[model samples]
Target chain A: MISYLLRRGSRVVRIILFISFCNAVLAEVEIYGEASYENRYFVEEGLFGQDKSHSSFTLSPEFYFESEDQKTSFTFKPKIRRDSVDNERNLFDIQDFSLVKVQDSYETRIGIRRDFWGVTETVHRVDIINQTDQVESFDGEDKLGQPMINLSLEREWGTLDLYVLIGFRERTFAGEKGRLRLPFPIDRNSAQYESSAENLRTDFAIRWSQYYQDLELALSHFSGTSREPEFKAALKNNTNLIIPYYEVIDQTGLEVLYIVGGLAFKLEAISRSGQGDRFSAATAGFEYTQVGILSSSLDLGWLFEFNHDDRYKDSPIALGARLTFNDLYDSQILSGVIRNEETGETNVFVEASRRVRNCCRLSFESVYFNEGTNSNSVQKTFEYLKQDDFARFEFIYYLGN
Target chain B: MRKLFKHFLFVSLFIFLNFTNADDFDRGLEIALATDKNFSGFGDSQTNLKMLLKNRKGFVTERKMKMKLLEVPNDGDKSLIVFDSPRDVRGVAVLSYAHKVGSDEQWLYLPALKRVKRVASKNRTGPFLGSEFSLEDLSFQEIEKYTYKYLRDEDLEGKGCYVIKRIPLDPYSGYTKQIVWIDKTDSVILQIHHYDRKSFHLKTQIFKGYKKYLNKFWRPNEIHMINHQTNKTTTLFFEEMTFNTGLSEKDFTQNSLKRSK
Candidate 1:
């Protein structure tokens, strides 16, 4: 696969050279690049003791070259990072590299990637995974090595759009003994499973989006299976619990005289099914924006969710609220019953951010999670505040024109 | 010999009248400014004005406005006007002065959204209502905005006029330069050549259908600007203009911006 990709890349380069030669008589080629750095700190109190801190500094650089005619363009980006914890020392790593091409209004990209998904915005990092555990779920540092290929195409028609993506990966997983045991019951030792071998996998996804004035609707589907033994084992064990799901998100909003806005409606359903069992969830919510009496913009929203499982004959309901001030401060509260067994859970979180300048910001966040039992309950809380709070700062500077 | 002397006298009288009229070109501009300056002279006077604004696409729109002049000056020399029409923008007002450096403010009340926004100290060369009429074009021509050089006597639209070229003094002005044709009869501006910042001829504004506002002041009821490059046009019609109704500076304050109507 590596050789094939290199051959293709060389062919593309040759084509670009030919095109440049042909256009060299009339126009000049332009190359541009930009670089930025970000420092993030996370503090938490729970699980593995009272105080745990993770700090990472990241550098992202991108380059692009275009023909004078501008009909064709190419872009490349490489991300690198350095991380430190407590005062114990530090480590460096390379993340991934991406390449993109554009022709007219159509664009094509292939590379190891990270993307945000879902109406509620979930993070999904493809291919590269050095750090096993992180909230954003991707390696914090650049590895310079281990990159995957990702391809995507998108087209628009009037107010409607269609997008498709495909990804290829070759990865290795640790053996099943010790810390690598399967999380659930599965045929981990089967001949079909190779826990510590090189593997290949493919993922396919499609999305359709349509808009009418202020109303928008989106429907997307992703279905792919990986061949890695660990993944296969995990899938087999959770087959009953893992369902192939589809989601429909619809949003209708209004901007009253370009101010004092409000949006009403529901996220009808997200349903999944596997074998003979079916699982589904639905939510409805309303949001409003108003000038608070204190001369600040305030957003208030409420949501309710209902979930059902045919195999377990379980049904659950959840309620949530979100309040935001000046779009910079936000607080959320959610409580729900997990199953017909009446397993209850509640979560609350608040975050605030202040812009130091065009390129810098200061932020603070805290979260609390509680699990309720028939007779007793357990609770965990996490909070993170910038230490220098007053002195800690980030700066983003641009180079070139 | 006596017949020859009589003929020469008649020809010389004709020449003297023509030269005097030529000299009165600036006087006409002065009269036009003075007519708009006197507030009490115009009492309940109504007139219809037509405006045409053009872009690259040629004639884009035409507006017909009815204007009512209320009061002139204390001695009844100048006037104030109010505009009414184009349902979306009915209660808009403008106060103008013939003098330079004096505050000439405009207030607009949008009834649909129930808010009044005051236009304050804007660049004179900026477009009015997204049209080619710069704020400078609407306001009375001030000497400070431009340095005028009298060119020569010429004929435009069948009227004898003094052609003068003016270079704008404002460094940030949208127009690099301008040329105006002032009628020798009443100081009426008949045509103007507007140049872009790059010193390129961008547009031309023409004035016509002159009417005497108070017998001494001739105001053009129709004006048209043709964008040479874009071939588009925009027209503003002053439906109703009332000169003076005891409008005070207090009415132009920020507190009144949200409640003008």
Candidate 2:
């Protein structure tokens, strides 16, 4: 199965390279990327008999080409990760392969691409264009490339972006041997879809964004197969496995950011239909920064956010701080805590990183989950992670220019 | 009768001193306006820059970037800086819209996340790219951002210059005042001595290798800044500075920041 996936991945790369080769005759090409080694140590062993520690290596390289006039450009990026313990944790992806053409007042991009939306730091409720690469990180900040044809129009009123998405990418999950896996293994091949076309369903999205003096706002709507899935327990090979069901969804999202002085107020709200009910969710917050704090070249930023979901009984509040040492090494640290309102469960995470020499970087991250006394649904969903606290260290060596 | 005579004498002296100060202020403003006008009407410019940052211990690191600037008719210039080196920050760009009267606007583009984030421009005192130059030091010096006073006339590097002291009007400025030397020949700034907020001599920036472009614009090919307090230095070397690049407003917009290579 892995070999088949690798073969399919290579085919996509070949097609991209052939098209780029034809364009390279008259274009200037630039190549750059990084190779990183990461190690993760779990404070406690997994309840499913996982290893105490795991290591991995990742490589992601990018090639870019631009015409002499700068009116046309192309980018191709592919990433691969190899895990030391779990096969399911391994990954291979074509993150970006897009060709862009610019005109007087408009631009168009075609092929697989990754686009980001929303502005909040904690949770991104409106950034739903791409599926999450769960095995890479649980924060959902990592995304899989989506095949799309995007058109962007610039007008006096605002900017409008229209997207015609071609296919769907299901979220990757941890296997049984993975540290963050659920109690039962997930059957990767047993995914069911509400749409008859399944992974081939065509999706559509549009976004309009504008900035006025001190405020920036965006409104976006997407109608397609949902990036999120519901799990159903099924008996396969005399063992119970969780099967994923992808449902059709229509979602509308709004993002607003108001900046005044050193404080930034942000909001990301979304209304979605077709899962179990039409539900509304919002994450509202503010980030206040004290630059050059305490007569030193250090900036301390305070983040406060309130997250609400109509489908869940919990309204979690997160508090975080980001410290940037405006030093020679460009050191930074971010730490946050989220407390569940109904269950009293807490989640704490910290990330610190600094540049090493000129070509390398070192980073450390740790995540801890404190259990709640109540047996609420939100707590139950995260109960498995209570003992899966882990600390991770990464060393990245950049290459090329 | 004697006390009244003394009060009148003091009042007259105060009026005379005020009159002399007003003349100095007008002359300072006139010189600043002349310098601003001398560099005007270059429509746009594109330049490549290499920055060498040295620590107190003499360890040097290099950073490469490209700059595009659009001269606004009456307000502050719009500029975009794209980093090309220090591999981790490659493709990261900063877009700035500086105004004459109020605070400047800035945005940062992070290529890793494809995020164009609005940055608080009030942090102008912070170092840029770990270099000796602060964000404020890099921006175009709008005439309205400071109030000036004529200090003296002196010769710098064998060229006659007008020495002036300018106090920053921004409440959050890192420097209390700056002493600037503008060459009399072309009105180009030759050097500046920056004073910290505590009234201590902090840094000195020297502009060298002046070359005339289009016979009207004088640009310095090299800028060297030294921090007196930290004993650190940063030198900027410019290359291929072409003016009138035909860059429009569309090129400096937020969307363009994402596409900036």
Q: Rate the local accuracy (lDDT) of all candidates.
A: 0.40, 0.88
Interface RMSD over true interface Cα atoms for each candidate: 19.3, 1.2
Native-contact recovery for every candidate?
0.00, 0.54
lDDT per residue for candidate 1 within A1-401, as digits (tens), equals 24433644564456446445644553442222222233333333323232333433444433445554433444444443333332211222223344444434434444543332222211111211222222111212212322334333333432111222232222222121111112332332332312132123233444444433334355554434331212332255435221112122122211111111233333434444332334444433333322122322233444444544343333444444444442211222222222223444444444444433222334444444344344433211111111111111233332222
Taking every candidate in turn, the Cα RMSD to the unseen true structure, in Å, is 23.0, 3.7
Clashes of 1: 64
Q: Identify the runs in model 1 with alpha carbons over 4 angstroms from their true place.
A: A1-46, A49-51, A64-71, A86-106, A113-117, A121-134, A137-199, A226-261, A266-278, A281-284, A291-342, A372-401, B1-261
- Give the Å shift of residue A68 in candidate 1: 4.4
Q: How displaced is residue B227 in candidate 2, in Å?
A: 1.3
> Given candidate 1, what's the lDDT at residue A40?
36
State the TM-score, rounded to 2 decimals, of chain A in model 1.
0.51
Residue A205 displacement (Å), model 1: 2.1
Cα deviation in Å at residue A307, candidate 1?
A: 6.5
Q: Is the docking of candidate 2 incorrect, acceptable, medium or high quality?
A: medium
Position A294, candidate 1: lDDT: 35
DockQ of 1: 0.02
